[model samples]
Target chain A: MSDKTTGNTTGTDNFPQENNESVKREMFKPLSRRSFMKAGALGALMIGGTATALLPLRNFKNDTSLENFFQQHYERLTPERMERILKRIEREIKERHGVDANVQDPKPIADVQFAYALNISRCIGCRRCVHACVEENNQSRNPEIQYIRVLEMPAGTFDVEKSDHYYSHETVPAEGKYYMPVQCQQCENPSCVKACPVSATWKDKDGIVVIDYDWCIGCRYCEAACPYWARRFNFAEPNIPKEQINPDMAYLGNRIRKKGTMEKCTFCLGRTRKGLLPKCAEACPAGARQFGNLLDPESVIRHILREKRVYVLKEEMGTRPKFYYWFDT
Target chain B: MKNNYKSVQNEAVPEFIRNYGLFLFQAIRLSFRGSTAFYAWMIFLSLLSFFGLRAYCNQFVEGLITTGMTDQVSWGIYIANFTFLVGMAAAAVMLVIPAYLYKDEEMHTIVIFGELFAVAVMVMCILFVTVDLGRPGRFWHLIPGIGRFNIPVSMLSWDVVALLGYLAINAHVCGYLLYMKYLGKKPNKLLYMPFVFLSIAWAISIHTVTAFLYVGLAGRPFWNSAIVAPRFIGSAFTAGPALMIIAFQIIRMTTGYHIGDRPFRLLRQIMTISLLTTLFLLGCEVFKEFYSQSLHNSSARYLFFGLHGHYALVPWIWTAITFEIAAIIILLSGYSRKPGSFVWLNMACILATVGIWIEKGPGLIIPGFLPTPLGEIVEYIPTYNETMVCVGIWAIGALIFSWMLRLAIPILSGIFRKKNE
Candidate 1:
């Protein structure tokens, strides 16, 4: 993505001619120690002035103050500059958060065709996925980062069942209630990405819609814009118990989210990047959640898509969600 | 000489003390006998504040666990209030433009009231946002260079700048005019006109940028439409002008201070145009959603006709439509055009204002987020504390409006003459 030497071409061309003229002028001048000292002093002063002029420009390049950062906007940042920014971010994280956060530059998983499938017949509505998500991603306990919502749809009825959203205690999924777990589908064309005026949210190369927390303004536009209600806003700082916070965190995808920004599941990119399964997939006692590369013909997701009678939520909208579900018929 | 001697004797007890005593007595009597509406509102807000404070305390003590919002419904009433109030703020610009730019004499009498209303609304908007935030102290980060503003990428940057600028301009323009009127002098016309133009452009920018904030998000299918901006502006104008009409009538009836017939007619005309535009925009939105029939189309359907019988928002949508239609009919009728129909028109305006508030405020934003990102629909009903905070902030805005009017109206009407003689 970067063409580094190409950037200095204009500067390189300007330097030679200026140097030749100076050398020619030097040849005509008398050689003396005193004159040389004077020449060196003048050269130093010129260099100092040029450096001074460039200092502000350099500061402009590095200054991450809110206003200047907002002024430059998000799309304008180059990859190298972004990397430097990430390093600065890591340094700040260490300084403020007091944890040595490992900042990894994980390239977007290529040709993976990541997709999720769920067996609605097997899901017992235990809410293990919700707890798993809170632990996997450093989510605040207050508002809670509930990436997956398990709806207890009544059996033999396609209609949404009357179930309390705040269902608690040891009561198991009742006789008639069938569990439906929902999260971000990692759509082919995401509406949340399109609705962002500042391009704060976008679909990465791997088809996951991700938000740069630093760039998001807590406008909650993305939260309102999503048809699936997938996005969540941090009205306050997410409170995660220190001991429970998963130390391994993704930079832009999932970290300790600040107050006044939007967040959602990124398919557990931080874990999936390291060749591990998502926490929800790991926590499912019934083995209801399935994750695999859809592009691989031998993968479970691909097999399910090809053989099983599978359906995506809101398929008619052309959002092209990667998540799928199937019945046990 | 006998009269002078008597007057001197009367003044021997110290005139300042006597006058001060009389002022205190009048204030005490007024407090005792006047309508308890203000105190009632205060008590209600206090109760709300107490509950809200408790909720906030829990939120701080335990984190966001105090609220019902999960990852799916991260945004609730607070955000809806933010968007709604931003629209309200923009609506207030209607009075500023006509009164200052066009120099409409009839609008001039009530324009400051609009400015006062804007100030009040903006205050509430900011307050709601503050309470909604996890770290309210971080708000100062938005100050131009202090915290980073992600400008072109974030409409929030523009929102912050515009809101602060509008507040400053309103204070300066309204304050100067009031001060001049108080001193019984002509206002400095030169200073106000520049700010007036700034305010006009600022008004449009505030609402348009807020619309852009929603439309910019590409991930959300429902919010990514091109129509959101125009729709927001239309709603803002309709709601704002209607509110002004209601306020004018209330003032007229209670204080017997008539703003005259011409101004009301002009306002009615503005409201009519705004309402028509609002309806047209809404029609376009409906057509687009139905015609496309894409995955994104489901949310609109859910909002209008309840997907899978969730049906919570159905009543609000119906109420909005009914009140909007009724308001338009009344304004367009021959009876509405009659001079004595101010009372009826005011009533219609009030209803329409309430309707639009419900629609744009809570109706549009919340339903769009249902059926979580994971495809699970979670029902969201705002807690009692949320409602209370909303009421309290609204009361705070009203208090500001009342105080500003109390100070401005007395001077503007020439009722309180200067002591120059």
Candidate 2:
């Protein structure tokens, strides 16, 4: 049993011992000049190789400034600092895309909780809102990113599995089908905000779930945590054509995003906070989209909530989404 | 206790610090000296790592588009590897438990290797996570005071804390032992014994926390199961000991040390029980998913069978299941006592290790993102660049483990010791 306990040693014949003994002798020997020179040369080669490898970083110098790198989180920044950042962003945009962008940081209005109501019954699957959103948000064009996805569900069932996101009907909403455009629910209890390891996203006071793009580490944990599949990651650099760039940008809203940050529907806060309709609402050919402050008792969204059979998507997930969907009333 | 007192009394603090510096220098020198095979292996790993770095550089320049991940399937093989290595790091506790808890002399003699293995695995886990990040340069943003660290709410924050804490505990415990041995002094029980128990519990926490990182996501029903944590522990136990069994054999052969058969037998026995437990947990998950047939079970269906005529993971999961079952059968064959059955045991270990890696890695992560929340099916196949990065991480891990062994084996075998100064 004792001999068997040294089982691995018995297999030493498989491993040549002559080399190991020599290796040991080499280790115990005094530091030889030849070996020292070899080590020094190897070290120099590694250092030089590393320096050469890092040369490509020079290209990134145009985007990654020291001020941008050390910028504080959005919530912590003072108004003056925010103004400075906005100016810096505009300068960067001007330099990169040759667009004179107006970058602002709009705070949520007092006593305003923005809510959206989409009339699914009146919705046509024309996909005009999808394109309008992309153009308005300054989203990438080549690797196309559209915030809203219009799922064509059969009239008989609400099961999303049977719905077709890639339906090519080549006409208006096909017979026996209804269109439901899904975007960020702006959940009161958002899973994405909770899942962020860095608190780069939060639910704003006015019910808009916003992301601090500068602060986001682009982990995409928030993307995985969103039940609505609302979040979009910039897998590559967002390439908005120079003429197509949206100049009316807010820091927390539709500002041009860097590659590797998370972006999503901010309830069109750049427009909505300033009392303008979201581009999707404005662009819908049919009167299928409604945007209003839910806090106003007489608002259209509040009226829909009180009278219409309004339902939130994935309500069973307990996400308390401010975005409501309802049939014609 | 008396030996600890004598050392404290005799060795001044300055002398001790000086001795530690010399010991580290010697270790660095010794790590550089190895056989022809060792140099060949290190060079091969270094080349792979260099290629991996170039791939990563391309990824950095081009963004994550270089990988197979899309907005639909956001995470790919990097996260899969990170999840697998977290379990690997946690498994070292199996050795720690026997050596320190049960007072097994054989295990006590060799448990440092397991702790060192944990350190090496933690490095890989960190590397995998870093490579997976979209903004790896923004890593300092996770620093508690400097950047916002969402704790208590985000299970990932918990995972970061748990993984780093486990790394520290294992490093301290084993590093103290090795340094003590090199100094030819008895290890102070007060310094490391408490940490040993802490590390045992901490090991379980790291894996449990990692499991929670997935299971806490209510959006992905594929991961939102109560049994995920237990399954993680079970599979981690299986894979960790299997690696140790093979690694100990290599150590014994290369270093010509008497590692004994007891550790191997004990690890084999562990592999047997944990393999059964892991399979049982897997069966429980399958039964729940298939029997109930809820809408939530679509991910499981996609994993086991096919969904919407897309079945990339079906063959992979089946292969993993086959490998795990075959390993169990071989381990339970009762031929472990015979000296010549080492070949069969080694085969079983390799099979189990690979099986568990598949069971936890791609088989778990990919399926969670399939039939996505809105029920769209987009398949993810890892790109070649991403594959090389994973291979690079694993090669770096192996390199670290080898280097640690180089420094450790000589001291453990009493060849390198402090002179009587």
Candidate 3:
């Protein structure tokens, strides 16, 4: 891909003649340094303007061609290409944003896999997961963009027993029910991907469904399509105070998202890709949340899935969610 | 001498009174016809929009945190308006299909009017969506081949295509018809069949795609149900056709022009069927939710009844149900079929329109997100700015509707009268 632009024969003739002519022309002119400098600046200005105009067009083609080659949706990218892309992403982030955002490229654990196991019994309905998600995913402080929600279900009934959605009090788990936190299940067969007429979002190799925020058009179709209600729309500019903004961002998953797009949790892919546990997993003080690679047999997630008789939130839908929950036996 | 004096006085008084009255009427008429009244209305809305726009700017600057929406209730009235107006746009096809395809003579006169309404509503829908977005300017990113097309994976792509296609079709057909009328030429017959078929297909596509947006969500149990698509179609037709009826009545009352009783009666029948379908669809959803009594049942219960102490949505839901029932009752009565009863029926239809808007719009999506997957409940309340922005968009739609009718109605009346002549 890089060779196509650099090695193209079309520019070689023009460049050789142009460089020789410029040198010969300079030798013949023998102008003072000041005059030569002025001429050079003028020439440079003209070249700069032309380049600026043509740069966008060239970049446009490059982007499209690159996207075409890389366009195997999300799941189709091979490991080698994914790695290269990750490296390229890290480089671009550093060069453009001037931010030291960590790009994760964790090797797939051989035996130890990752899966999310939620402990329904110990959940206090504090919604710490929701907060952690915002911090982890670098979400806009706009209350609407939360990637996870912890519903306060009442005792004896699993309904959305609202003790107070705005529960800011010191003592939580207020009286009746256990809290349940819901985020993207990273479904094995995500309906959202199927419903998309345009393949703007897809499950990456790491079992995280990621949306190219740049590609999303803020249509809310994904928001409506997600059975988990995991998708969120950036209705307004995400306003994380500069100080609070999470510096560690992912290119496709958790980079600072713009307005007018759909977003959801990618299991903190920005962190997980770097061999770090998701922020929500880290934030759960009660050990109610556990995340690990589902592909690893020796991982904690596999142990929980095997020994605890874990169940998915909505198994009847057959989404095959990677997230699981088990009662305390 | 006395008789002459009396005759002169009577003649002078009657002539002066008649001429003065005519002058006053003409002045009022001129004020309405020119840009004065129009600009006045524009300025008034602009002032309201100015304040709303300020709030919107604040929202953009401060972030969505300024809104009443919390994590649990991610969507609010903006989305509801988006859904409602899109349905309105689809419903415009009702006139397009009948007039162009089936060649329904009764509908031919009003078909362009319907298209005009569609253009207006679509504009409104698009505006509401823009306001709902975190970055409204990025909307152009959906243009294919230029921006990314996440084919088979993103509904946003489909929505952009469908909406743009529908708008283009409406614009082409309406613009051609209007130009033909302006030139005093007959509308080209060749365009009719293609347009008719397209309109029918397009109508279904718009609503179906909108439904697909919801049904595609595999995570939200309430929205994941199979009934969402049918319910959307049912409610859209009901509310959309009903809105058309109300619009017709408003035109009649304001202009003293008539669209004939037959079309009104025909629309009433359409509304009835739509309303019944909507009610049935709503019932099916309820039955499935309650009968299964699964985890999904809680969101439904919370919406219908106060979940815990938060009773905010319950009253709204009950109101929608009551009004919908009342609308059905009014439509079912024999008196409603009469020409004189059209006004009352229109009122009922208007109520049904609002009822469905509330039911399908905010009522559906907000509660579905309430008991978040983690069993957390967060209340969603739309702020005053959100409400104002909504009203501002509605006003823009109304403004578009008014102007489009101003242009189309006179031409329509002329065409119909010419045909008769």
Candidate 4:
């Protein structure tokens, strides 16, 4: 009701018949002083119209402050500036979700490129990893922004066209189907990074693609660019239960995201940057998910590449994704 | 004493600047408390526009979830309409090309209407982009110095530059010419002729860059074609001239502006050539997609025929194709040329307008994401919010065009001068 009457227009169309008649009487008055008054009234209407247009920003002004406006790019920020941002995140997490989160900014190690591999044969169709990822990533619960989607496809072929996502069956892992979970492949030549008109998202030296959420304008060009269907947008304010908020957070990883921003699986940067496994890998009951440094000669990903027939999705597009899938046969 | 002070202030301003402000006030004054029918039309559009504004507020509060788009069909109603409107904006160049190049005297008389229409469409284009943005508050991110506009890298950035530049050039040209017309003075050719020439190239660039927004996406095979840019220009030409021809008749009825038979006849020829080109381009695109049967052709296949029993878009694409074909036959026939055949001409024009809108809008943007990146077909049905907002944006455009016409007609017909005489 409040938004319905913008511009003090009092237009004849929205009114009752009696009211419209009166408005027409008022509208068809004589010339001279009235014309100037009408111009003045119209000027006021124009100003009111502009104010209504800007009303959406009022709810967001405090969240994205002057500091956020002036904040340097992720790569350009000094150690002190980075520390201030990390502290702000800590404060925001405590206030919004009532969780005392340790929001850190972990720099990439020298010459260590991240890689992932998932074994299709051993994987079960259970969706525990999907829920676990949401809680771990601090994703919204109201509209439910879950990062990972597991597809159940026919066993004979891997054609993505025939896959089903909204499945409900009697038992785990149906007879003629194989389950494959898909997320951001963290492409070495990530199109999402190139698609960001604001340079808000980029790949670090570690080949772990990340987004500076504060800097992002939420154009969704990146969302459209990703071939893996990896990106998720925050359409409204994220509504997460206070008790369930993840206390361990990373600035570019699983920290609480704002409304109208894009979030995706960042490989659990809070844990993985400390040399721990991604939650999806750790939660998989069938030991299907593998995460390791692609450059490390002894890493499991390197061993899988050397010993097995491994493949990346959409090879012709040449995204050069770090995530890979393999079969034991 | 007050008159002396006012006169001193007035003398400091340049004569052109003084007239610019004076003519704007005159235009505004003319727009108020129109005739009963005019009031009815204005009120109806205003009410619809306000309802649209209210719907946007709901969208802002409830998030984009209120709309029926998911990650699968990420860009929906807002984007589809945006694509069609850019074609509308670029259509003004058809008026410029014949008037300036061939120096056709009748075409020269109506060129201001096209330039003014471009300005209105430009406003609509910017509004659609803002509404589609997830964080509209962060609009400053596109401002070059304030934030990063990754020019030459992102096609979106290129589109922004092209669109805004076209608006500025056209607005300047129209403003200069119209203010001069109001003052009964010949416009200085040097001041505006250069910009008018530049706007022709700028017009083509706006739609081509918008096509690049979709074509550059390698992941979506549906849009990854060289055919996109040329098809964009062709469809734009067809729609633009067709709309202008209809508009001329309406202006004659409402404002007694005497546009004779020559103008509409010339525009009909332009429309025939461009519509044929668009249809031919469509044939090539369909044949390539059908013959090769590449995996990328799934979206095109989905458009023409049913894909996996998801036949929603089947009717829409066919209707558009049928309309275009029917309109062409009507134009090619002598019935359109017969005296009192305006009914047939109006039907053809309406068919072309709606057909091209359908072909460029939902037919182009939606099907591109049908078998999404993950090969899932989550069909998009634009929710009430999407429809209302879409309606509101269009009403806004109509209101702008109506107001521009309302303002221009009085001056063009010389009623103010006659009254003085």
Best by TM-score: 2
Lowest summed lDDT window (length 10), candidate 2 chain B? B1-10
iRMSD values, candidates in order:
27.6, 5.6, 25.3, 13.0
**Evaluation by lDDT, superior candidate among 1 and 4:** 4
TM-score rank order: 2, 4, 3, 1
Full-model lDDT for every candidate: 0.67, 0.86, 0.67, 0.81
lDDT of 4 by residue, B1-421 (tens): 1232243248779966655655554455467856667767876787678767867877776667778878788888888888988998899998898888887666766788889889988989998888888877777778898778788798888998998999999999987776665676677999999998999999999999999998988898889899999999988888878888898888756644556566677778878888999999999999999999877888998888968878889999999999999999999998787764478877888899889999999999899888888888988899998799889988898899888877665555443211121
Candidate with maximal DockQ: 2
- Candidate 1 TM-score on chain B: 0.86
Residues forming the 10-long window of minimal summed lDDT in candidate 4 chain B: B412-421
Candidate 1 CAPRI classification by DockQ: incorrect
The residue ranges of model 4 lying beyond 4 angstroms of the native Cα positions read: A1-30, A33-63, A69-72, B1-9, B12-16, B413-421
Q: What share of the true interface contacts does each candidate keep?
A: 0.15, 0.45, 0.28, 0.37
Angstrom error at residue A92, model 2: 0.8
Each model's DockQ score: 0.07, 0.43, 0.12, 0.25
State the TM-score of the second chain for every model: 0.86, 0.95, 0.86, 0.95
Cα displacement (angstroms), candidate 2, residue A151, comes to 0.6
C-alpha DockQ for predicted model 4: 0.25
In order of DockQ, best first, we have: 2, 4, 3, 1
lDDT of 1 by residue, A1-329 (tens): 11121212111121234543453343223436975575576457545544542332322112144542443333556777767766766676565567766665465787876789998888888989889887888777875657777777767655332444555547767777777887888888776775554566788777677877766655555565565667777755566655666667787666677665678899888888667888899999988899988789999888888888899887766788988998665
lDDT string, candidate 3, B139-164, tens digits: 44555665446555566557767777
For model 3, the superposed segments whose C-alpha errors exceed 4 Å read A1-184, A191-200, A218-249, A252-271, A274-308, A324-329, B1-55, B97-102, B253-258, B283-295, B338-342, B413-421
Off by over 4 Å in 2: A1-25, A33-62, B1-13
Candidate 1 ranges with C-alpha deviation above 4 Å: A1-329, B1-68, B256-258, B291-295, B371-374, B415-421
